[model samples]
Target: MIICELKNNQRTDALVSELVDIWEDSVRATHSFLTHADIETIKLYVPHAIKAVPHLFVARENTGSIHGFLGISGQKIEMLFIATQYRGHGLGKKLIQETMSLYPITDVVVNEQNQQAIGFYEHMGFEVYDRSAIDEHGGTFPILFMRKP
Candidate 1:
């Protein structure tokens, strides 16, 4: 079972490796990205930035080890990662349900290449507002701007 927690001061208390492991697993499972290095970069800087924006939900195993997470920057989803082993049990959808109630509008950016995520977001009630030519370094990387209000 997945337990959802509101992001707060104790988020970084989760081990960095477990967080990275979640990303590593998810990216591989979804065929979205190439490696865990993106998460490695986050581990280096996200903790310090957490104080400025402290809302992050870290998923822990029943044994209390971090396995996946979803972070919110206001109503916008900043990060969502689920360890491969723990996915398909509804953690991702649960996180969205638990988080979206906190805001009036919720928006998420899904990389164009990630077909699985695109379908998942659509299933979750987010609608694609517009497609862009990669503004904000978006051109080379297509981003589906999804909004649910």
Candidate 2:
């Protein structure tokens, strides 16, 4: 697989749509705590979020099929999603490692109910430093704020 940062002009609508599909698939696979309605509601903002993130990196196969992506803003990882079939194959880790080498990434927020994600972040050397009863969107899902320190 190859990982590369996307240039501004490369973030076309078609790419955003593809990323959104990956995001939704990943969310459905890992975020079982979310109801269908919750997913639908959150999906509305994903495209915009993908477009607005300061740095976007994609992991793709040699054949040029994207399998995962990471989004960073400031010193935080705003998003990371791997296609369901690509999970556990080190693509996510590669993305994080590559981005950390280029950016001073220190923080990431994960859903408390998503134990798999929490464990993954912990394995990646992040520790929970704070917690919130609601998500950023004011949803009921708890949030765990982690930092690499």
Candidate 3:
């Protein structure tokens, strides 16, 4: 698979919808801490967040269909999600490496309840430097602030 920057093409609308699906599927698989209500609530903000992201990239097959995406703002990775079937294939590491090549990514925040994600970030060379009792939006879920040395 090849990774490429997501451009606003004629298929932008359809692609955005697909990306949201990937996001939901990924969250459902790993975020066992979330209730149905919590998932629905967070879904409300994802589309808007996707639209507001300044930089976005996708991992695609030779057929050019996207299987995962990453969004970054400056040096922070605001979002990253792989289609459920694409996880554990090192595509996420590829995306991070590509993004880091383009930006000085020094930090990331992960939900403490999402152990899989926390482990993945740790494996990718980040270490927890701080903790918050609540998420960035003041939600009840705790968060871990990690940085790469």
Q: Rate the local accuracy (lDDT) of all candidates.
A: 0.68, 0.96, 0.89
Encode model 2's per-residue lDDT on 1-149: one tens digit a residue: 88999977899999999999999999999999999999999999999999899899999888989999999999999999999999998889999999999999999999999999999999999999999999998988899999999
Backbone collision count in every prediction?
Answer: 3, 0, 0
Report the error of model 2 at residue 26, Å. 0.4
Write the number of the candidate with greater TM-score, choosing between 2 and 3.
Answer: 2
C-alpha TM-score for every candidate:
0.76, 0.98, 0.95
TM-score, predicted candidate 1 vs. hidden true structure: 0.76
**Local lDDT at 54 for model 2:** 89
Question: For candidate 1, lDDT tens digit of each residue in 47-72?
Answer: 45443444666666677776677777
Q: What are the candidates' C-alpha RMSDs?
A: 3.3, 0.7, 1.4
The C-alpha stretches of model 3 lying farther than 4 A from their native spots are 8-11
lDDT, model 2, position 42: 96
Q: How many Å off is the CA of 96 in candidate 2?
A: 0.2
The superposed Cα distance between candidate 2 and the true structure at residue 107, in angstroms, equals 0.3
